[model samples]
Target: MAINKLPIKKLVEFRRLSKGRQQTFANRLKVTKEANSGGGDYWVRSISTISNAFRVNDNALIKAKLEEVSNLYNAEQRSQTKKMYKRNIDILTKYQNFDFSEWWPSTSLNFLPKPQSILEMHGLPIQIRPQQIFSYGAENNQSVGGIWLITWLQGYKDEDLGIYSEALFRYLSSYYSEDYIINPAACMVVDISKMKVIGYDKVIDGEIPSLLDASIAKIKAHLN
Candidate 1:
């Protein structure tokens, strides 16, 4: 049997959905064996720019990338692609002035490749993929790191943010614990739309694991 795969953001959204919606999502997942690649390059361009900016400590790259997209938006003739480019332009413009130093003062960011691991839930192999990982300096001279999952969707409640943070924390702690100490300060879900960061320290729900397990069980049942 082929194992099911879900990005961390989709899994978090699934957890917050109503029972009816969960089943609907599960049915869609079951039938859609291939990855959905229909979305435009807005997220792809933006994420790459953000990653490159951190890797080289150059915020200018952000504006540079925005200009590239803006130029394309201006000349595009297709309405749909033009709309996508326009949206990307707006998002990149907002992010161009963002100060990474404010959130990660005095720390260096070294970007690692995206991480993925298979999680067995209710006798099912569910692959979880988080977007980015970076190692940063800590106060005690300890080597610690964090995983960041970006979300373009808006209106995520605090509870949703907490669940997303906890899920990313568990993914790193379970898979990469031997390599580096996963710091709560490092793990985060970056809300690009609102220019907000939700860190692992904000995960207040002690029952997150149980909640996730229940959500997984429901997903498994619906898969059948």
Candidate 2:
């Protein structure tokens, strides 16, 4: 591997390339159009608002900084959710503070990939930028009775669900699960009937479902 420094030309070239792949910017454009909120580059300001800026190319620099941002975001969300979960627990157990840390994200909600190519969804505290992960795997970690919760993160603005759903289902049939016997080259089974688990594509064309859905489903499957 070699480290290539970006010259003026390279920078310009890279900027064009990146701007084309500017997912966040495209999203901002959509939201502004949809909400009609007198848009004034809120997302731009948010990115610029980072305290200590680091170079884009350095992996260590990017990871550390992004993780720091994510930690703060994920922790806050978990705490808020914990408060609610605590209330629920109290309602059930008569105000006993049962530990809600069970799933209340020690880290933050971010997509982390392991050595085995099994991407694990973690407690996402901060915003996960593009460089943080490549592709998504299953949703969150609580796999009960050999079933997994898979979520497709939004790809583009409008049909983000379709992008992820299509990609993830393909992954299931081609690599991980191999639901049915499709052509080796065109190697994904399009239908769910042949799937091993009682899998789904319900929210494939929408926002991601919480990992708890998988957990609850596991419990329900056991009860049945």
Candidate 3:
């Protein structure tokens, strides 16, 4: 099949196939089906169907194939063909990381929002600023990308207790920035009832931060 000729419907058909069949098609298309830890196939399939419904037919796999195609054939001819589908291909590629699960908030959570709400339920307030265009070192000196509905916690004014601040800082820093970034210094958790602040230095200001060492364990400990 011509690399540039695969339509959106074809991808929809491929996406609907069983994992084994999808793997076979992936081999044929010369596209790497990157594996996610859980439900990767479902995500890929769902997104492909959504894109197809919108009549998007830009083939990212084809562009990579074109690079290979160029090595063997006339470069000028292939470049002209690429221009025809470049827009669709560019858009589809940009949405490759789309997560439907995260895009829609849980109705069950009463629209409380994820991560932040999750933290709140556990008696921690995640302070996220109003949505801004640029999050990382952009318009302002703020370092957070703030892509998630909730990004950084609020500044420590009323919550200026030392232990909480230190614990929050450690937790924020340990997180990956692939999706969003959080400020380590500015921490404003809304709920502090569960957190038993024993003393500074021992828990918060010591050489090792308890939040960092047992972030999950601490949460579970609190529940018990």
Which candidate number has the best TM-score? Answer: 1
Model 1 agreement with the true structure over 1-224: per-residue lDDT tens digits: 32356444555567767988988877777778532322424477776677566556677998999889888888999998898777667666776777766555235765665555666656766555555666656544544445453555445655566656766777777766777678875677666656677777665445223244555666667778
- Write one digit per residue (lDDT tens) for candidate 3, span 1-224: 11223221232344346757755654554342221122223223323333332222234443444344334334435664544334233433443443423321221111112233112213332222211112234333334311111101221222233334444443344342443445533232221122122222343445434443233233223223
Residue 73 CA error for candidate 1 (Å)? 0.4
Candidate 1, run of 10 with poorest lDDT? 33-42
Q: Which pairs of residues have clashing backbones in candidate 1?
A: none
Whole-model lDDT per candidate? 0.63, 0.26, 0.32
In model 3, state the lDDT of residue 203.
37
Rank the candidate models, highest lDDT first: 1, 3, 2
Q: Considering summed lDDT, which 10 consecutive residues are worst modelled in model 3?
A: 145-154
Ranking by TM-score: 1, 3, 2
Listed per candidate, the RMSD to the true structure in angstroms reads 3.4, 19.3, 20.8
Error (Å) of candidate 2 at residue 195 is 19
lDDT per residue (tens digit) for residues 1-224 in model 2: 01111111111122233534544433443344321212222222122222112112222432343445444445655676545333222222321222322221222222223222222222211111111122222444321111121111111221222222333333334343422221121111111111111222433423444233233232223223
Error of 2 at 203 (Å): 12
Error of 1 at 142 (Å): 2.7
Q: After superposition, how far is residue 118 of candidate 3 from its true place, in Å?
A: 0.8
Off by over 4 Å in 3: 1-116, 119-136, 139-142, 145-163, 166-176, 179-181, 188-224
